[model samples]
Target: MMILKLLAPIILFAIAILQGLFAEKINKIKWLKITLICLLLGSLTVGLIIISLDEKNANNFSKQQKDNIDSLRIENAQLKNNLDSLHRALTKGMDDRSLQEIELNKKVSELNIKLEPFVKLALTKYPAYDLQSALNKIAQDIENAKKLAEPPILIPNAQEISRDKTGLNMLLQFKLSKNQSLGQIIFYAEIEDGSTAKIVEFWPSTKGGAFNSGPDSKMIAPDGKSSRLIYSLIGAGNPTFDLKVTKAVTVRITSNYLPEPFITKIE
Candidate 1:
């Protein structure tokens, strides 16, 4: 259709040229010459109209193509922005999961440290087939131990407190159920003579080193069923006191993965 429109103008113009040439040849026939000249002018006018209409149609087509291209570019830009946003969301999710995995691993390590004593005892005393059963029993016993109102340990007394000639020393004993472990301990002491003994620190023995207090400490609980902790105290220069003068001792004890601390007072 486009080709036919373009050709139509040229065909009309050609016919007009042919008619003008033929009219000159028939100059002798005056009426026929006039008719041929009129035909020539009419064809020329029609050709001009066809050319103008075709040019206008071409311009409209070009404008419509430009508008379509602009719409396509807008859609492409929107798609690219959506893809970028999705990528950012996925990256953030992965980073969050990584952090959660690290925290879970830390908790698992702490649990293993707390349970090491029980696992070892079970392996030594029970056969391989009965090891799991032994661990279950140990866990049950520890739960039962936690339910007791009184602490399952002997409070420190002047007779039980060992003294160092150079410094004040107080020792307390804890007799735990089989495979039970210890978590945290804090102490408060009072003297009968109303004197204060400045304490440096108190700690339990794990293996051969002092047990540190904190979440990071991975020290295994005391082996076997009994454990002891000692407190070292300082005094003014050479202050000394008779053991009989020792009055009250209070302790806050936390044991074996328990969530709360237990306060025990000995008089």
Candidate 2:
């Protein structure tokens, strides 16, 4: 635009000189008409050049504006995508946290249910106690109960040893100090004359019942002195011993609850 402004005056001056020289060579009226035509052409040429340059500049500006709009659109799309991704990630994280909390609560509930019985028992036993103290007291009480329920540990004492020669049998009497339920007893006999005595049957005079003995499941003791014969009898009984022995024999009676054995000699 600045270059066009500077050249406009120069172009007008050159046109005016050409027209003046032509006016001197032609008639006055014709010379005036020719000068008017030259001035009109020069103005038209300058106007066309200004319009062309303006159009070129306008086109360049429009192209740049379009490019800027396109860039902004792309940036806006990218921002939207990023925001969507962040939203999804946050939602998933919150869901995971909620699930974890639910699982933890469920486990706690199950544990509380399992402990409810013990808690009630403790509260009933110890009215004035904290939870921990009550639980400890409950455990100690359970241990005491187990100890009390155990059977008494005592060695058997054999008395009133007599033999009946007519029946060919021996009667041995024993009793448990504390009147408890009867347990199993294992007994065997060793003959003095180095003969093996096998027990065939056992009969007790006590009202409980006849004693039970198994001859098929007999086993020898580790010391080889007596054969193992198991008998189930009442706590107190005078059981008649029927054995296939021709010589004098010593009978030994033992039980799981006894620390020692009861022994009796019959001749």
Q: Which lDDT values do the candidates have, in the order given?
A: 0.51, 0.65
Per-prediction TM-score to the true structure, in the order listed: 0.46, 0.40
Please give, for residues 1-267, the per-residue lDDT of candidate 1 as tens digits: 465555656656765676678756677778876776666666566666767877888899999999999999999999999999999999999999999999999999999999898898876766553778989877777787776644333322222444444444444444333322333443322322323433333344332224444543232223211122323222111111122112344434444322355444434
lDDT of 2 at 91: 100
Give the clashing residue pairs of candidate 2, or none: none
Over 4 Å off in model 2, which ranges? Answer: 2-46, 136-267
User: Using alpha carbons, what is the TM-score of model 2?
Assistant: 0.40
User: Model 1 — TM-score against the truth?
Assistant: 0.46
